[model samples]
Target: MTADEVFDDIVDDLAGRGVSAGKMFGARAIMLDGKAICCLKRAEFGVKLGAGSAAHEKALALPEAVLFDPAGKGRPFKDWVALPASQSEHWPTLAQAAVQAAH
Candidate 1:
């Protein structure tokens, strides 16, 4: 999928689950009770959790969040990190971290 499609899918997932969300820097940003959960970039199909957001760390611990190389650097974080394709179900946890960083 294109980066934009990936980003939109994430935002759609969150919104589908009833999480408040928005957009910034052309990235899909989730908002929770007036807070942001994460920032998703369409070009890179990347999701950058807000500063101090623990979603990335938490996701790292799960097997679902495999480190993918999008930049051909063999580095997971260089270009983009693969979030669980099942992120829709993981929205609560992810969004919580986003809210934390947003606040």
Candidate 2:
């Protein structure tokens, strides 16, 4: 599925679980209690799973997965993972982890 479609599915699934759709750094994002849990940027699904956490490590192990760097600078968000379309299947699971971490 396309990134948009994947994002839609995540939003729908999380919405019922109390997550809201919002914007983060101008990108479409899933929010929990007003904090961004994940976002879609350039077809990449960026999720905040906390640095060094099990979820973060697993996500980084995925092909093409990387630390999120919105500005394209070397300074990346340690707690965020940027998952490419190839890793879309894992988005939901990681997104759930993000929500839990946020709580």
Candidate 3:
């Protein structure tokens, strides 16, 4: 699926979760309350899990996940993870974790 399609699927999955869609960093983002749980940055999705949290550590351990470092080789958002397109199947679960973390 295309990036837009993937993002749509994610938003659809979160339909009853009380999250909302809005613009963030010039991209589409899923928000909980006023905080961003995840955001679509180009073709990739960035999930927030809070720095040093167990969920953050676990996500980082996944082979398909990486630290969300949009600024290239610089200080990365240690809590956020860039979910791999190859691992789209895991997005729902990761997205849930991000939502919970955002709360």
Candidate 4:
């Protein structure tokens, strides 16, 4: 499936589980309790899994994963990771972790 399709599936699944769809940085995002859990920018899946958490470390270790910097500046969001579509297989799992972290 294409990146957009994969992202849509993730959003649909999360929404079924009570997560709400919203916007973040002008990109599509999934929210929980008014807080963003994750966002999709181009083919990147930016997720908030909490800095220094096991899930965050694991995600960063993935190929092409990096700290999310929406503005393209040196500063990056400590709790967010930008995962490329090449790592899409891990998207669903990490997305769930983001939701759990938000709780």
RMSD (CA, Å), candidate 1 to true, equals 6.3
Give me the overall lDDT of model 4: 0.90
The residue-level lDDT of candidate 4 at 21 comes to 86
lDDT of 4 at 96: 93
* Residue 41 displacement in candidate 3 (angstroms): 0.9
The number of residue pairs in model 1 that clash at the backbone is: 2
Per-model TM values vs. the true structure: 0.41, 0.94, 0.87, 0.94
Better-scoring candidate (TM-score), 2 or 3? 2
Candidate 1 per-residue C-alpha lDDT over 1-103 given as tens digits, one digit per residue, 9 for 90 to 100: 5444555665665674556657645546666665444555423323445323356666556655544344446665522235644554454455445434444
Error of 2 at 78 (Å): 0.4
The better-scoring model by TM-score among 1 and 3 is 3
Give the Cα-based TM-score of candidate 4 against the true structure: 0.94
What TM-score does prediction 2 earn?
Answer: 0.94
Candidate 3 regions exceeding 4 Å error are: none
| Displacement of the residue 75 alpha carbon in candidate 3, Å | 2.5
Give the per-residue lDDT of model 4 (tens digit) for 1-103: 8878888888888886779889999988888988888988888899999999999999999999999987777888999999888999999999999988987
Rank the models by TM-score, top first: 2, 4, 3, 1
Candidates 2 and 3 compared: the better one by lDDT is: 2
